[model samples]
Each structure stands twice: as structure tokens, then as C-alpha cells.
Target: MPEPIRTFRHFRDVPDSAWRWGNFSPAEIACRGTGQLKLHPEALDKLQALRDRLGKPLIVRSAYRSPEHNRAVGGAKASKHMDGTAFDIAMANHDPAAFEATARAVGFLGFGYYPRSGFMHIDLGPARTWGERFPVRAVPFALEVPAARETLAESRTMKGAGAAGVATVGAAGVEVAQGVLAEAQGAVLPLIPYLDSLRWIFIALALAGIAVAIWARVDDWRRGMQ
Candidate 1:
């Protein structure tokens, strides 16, 4: 016997994404309705709180799912959404990062900000998040070269050139490469400060342990001499 999913009547207006909804399998529906989703009641509370705090509907673009629904949407195999602990939401024409910040302030877990997708993914499980905001630029195709004129006069340097009229062109090629590199560095920057703090903390702990060991040895020697 378990508690039912705490559903807010106001949230009924929110859209349900691709889930089987009323057609969900018995087992799946039971899982979502139970306390197995630890934050079943809390999810409803936070959803309403977000709506009030943001002064918008804060539409739920997706919600609890069955395994079949999960497979159809290409969801991660271990998604919390299936258990009624996760929800995807979007505010009409709102910046996802700003909206996600709002969600984080409310102490909701799993706020994934996907700006391009125009929505944020949230869950009531672990306090963690991950999602890309911007578009992904791919390597550009090379430009074609015009035929070289063999009969035209050329400079000495032109004669020895490896290829004729095949020089690289346009800012796009350079821009895409830099964009990817910058994205990678931006991703790593968040971890660096935490890592530095840990390094200093580990060193301090090591020194403290060494001092304690020396004091213990000194006490042992004194007791033996007594």
C-alpha cells in the first residue's frame, strides 16, 4: 500500500509530452502513482511554487511515463520521468537559462537547461543537472576551386605553389572551430574552482593527520618511560 501521486488540479492544463497518458500499462501507472517516486508529493508542490514565483503558467511539456512511452521518446534508459519524479517544462517564449535559474532557486533537483529545445528538464531525484543550451556547429564543407589558366603568365612563387587557386576562404571555417573549443573550455571551467578547493583541503587534512600521529607516538613513549 503506497500513497498516490500528489497532483495539483491547476497543473491539469499543462501539456503532456508523448507519454501514453491514460493508456499507460497497469504496472507503469502503478509505479508512478506510488511513493516509489520519493518526491511524488513534493514534485506537485514545487511545480505550483514555480508557477507562482515566475508569474506564468510554467507549462509542463512532459511528465511521468511508462517504459513504452520512454522508449518512444528516446529517453535515457534509467529516466526518473517513468517514476513520476521528473517533469519537463517550458514558459512560452522565455529564456531557458533564466527559467532554469528560477527552478534552481526553488530547490528542485535535476534542472537541465536546454535553451535550443525551448524547455527545461527537471526531476526530484539526485541534485544534479546537465544539458546543452546552444546549437551545435559542425565542420564546414570545403570550397571548390576554379580552373587555373595554364597559358597566363605567373609569378615565380605561383609556379612552385602546391595547388592553384585552392587557398582556404571565409570566416565560417575558423568560427566553428573556435566555437567548439570555447564550449569545451566553458564546460571545464565550472569544475576547476571546485577541484582547486579540494586540493587545498586535502593538503590541510594530510598535515593534520601527520601531526596527530606524531603526538600519539610521543604520548606512547612517555607512558612507556613511566
Candidate 2:
């Protein structure tokens, strides 16, 4: 049996579970100009797989198109959008080369590069590629670091400051201990000089930590600017 076209007057009419594919809603693949929608299951399945492999959101520029909508947008007479097989995905959240590779791996065969528009078209049709490829980027898209990791790196400036606080507390603790030992006994007098020395060591460490904390804070600020 031929695969049936899933039609919706509006995406809102689609029951949530009716969309078997996860990570995508009927609205996302609906016709842009009209509320109407029609799509093939294979296309949505492949698209969901692509999204899963990428582990990120896809910025879909265009997907399904009604015949009227297709003509208004000056789409090809036989554009894949009408058949619900083509997708125009923006590269804002994706690296073009990587996106194409992943799209192909998920069974998309057609490629239409629109460098100036910053979007690419992919379809489950005859294997072919068209349009000018994007200029090789000096830097690929930055990997998304987990929020926890980013927060830890962003808080790096605090480490030195925290060390300084600890050292200051240590120095104060040494002085208090030195004073108590001074009043203990004559036999403990020999330990007095060492206690004083310990106090001085703590003070030196405290100063060093403070200096490091200052430098780290400055560096963190610079990074934020960049």
C-alpha cells in the first residue's frame, strides 16, 4: 500500500501522540503560508534521527508547502516541499559540513547549499548536490559545553580568592595559638620561636594567595569581555 499523506488543517489539531517521531512536532513540519500540513513518515523519521545524532535543535527554515504556498514562494513546480520530503535547515545552530554529513547518514540524499542565505536543503530523493558550498570556516562551530562545566570554568576566579580567605584564617589561627602557648609554661618556651615562625609563614602564604586571587579575577573579567 502507498504511504498515506497525513493531513492537518492546523498543526494544533494533531494529537501529541499522533506524532510518532520524537523531538519534532507537527507544527515544525507544517506548511508555512497556510495552516495545512502533509508529510511522509519516512521523511519525519529520518529528520528525527538526524536531530538525535546531532543532539541539538535544528533551525528549520522551510518544510512542507501547500501548492498555493509553493507557487507564492516561487518554489520549483515539482519542489520536494510539496511532497513533504525536503527541508530547508538554517546553519545558525549547525556547522554546514557537519550537518550535511549527518543528514546523509540519516538517509537524506539531495543537497542544496545556500551559503548567502545561511541554510541548506536536504531531501530523501535522488542523490544530488547543488549550489555553492559555504567557504571553509576558520573555526568550526564551538561545541556546547554542559551548563555545569561552564559554570565551573566561569567560577575559576573564585578559587584563588577562596584560597586567600583560607590563608588569612590560618594566619589568624596561628597567632591565637602562639599567644596561648606563650602563657603555658617555661618548658614550652622552646616552642615559642617556632610558633612565631609559623605565624610569619602563614602571613606570607596569605599574601601570595591574595595576589593570585587578584590576578585570576582580572583574567576572568578579560575572558568575559572576549
Return the top candidate by TM-score: 2
Q: Using lDDT as the measure, which candidate wins?
A: 2
Off by over 4 Å in 1: 1-39, 134-226
lDDT on C-alpha atoms for all candidate structures: 0.56, 0.86
| Per-residue lDDT of candidate 1, residues 140-171 (tens digit) | 32345875644424533333231221222222
Clashes of 1: 0
lDDT tens readout by residue for model 2, 88-113: 99998888888989999999999999
| Regions of model 2 farther than 4 Å from truth | 1-3, 146-226
C-alpha TM-score for every candidate: 0.42, 0.71
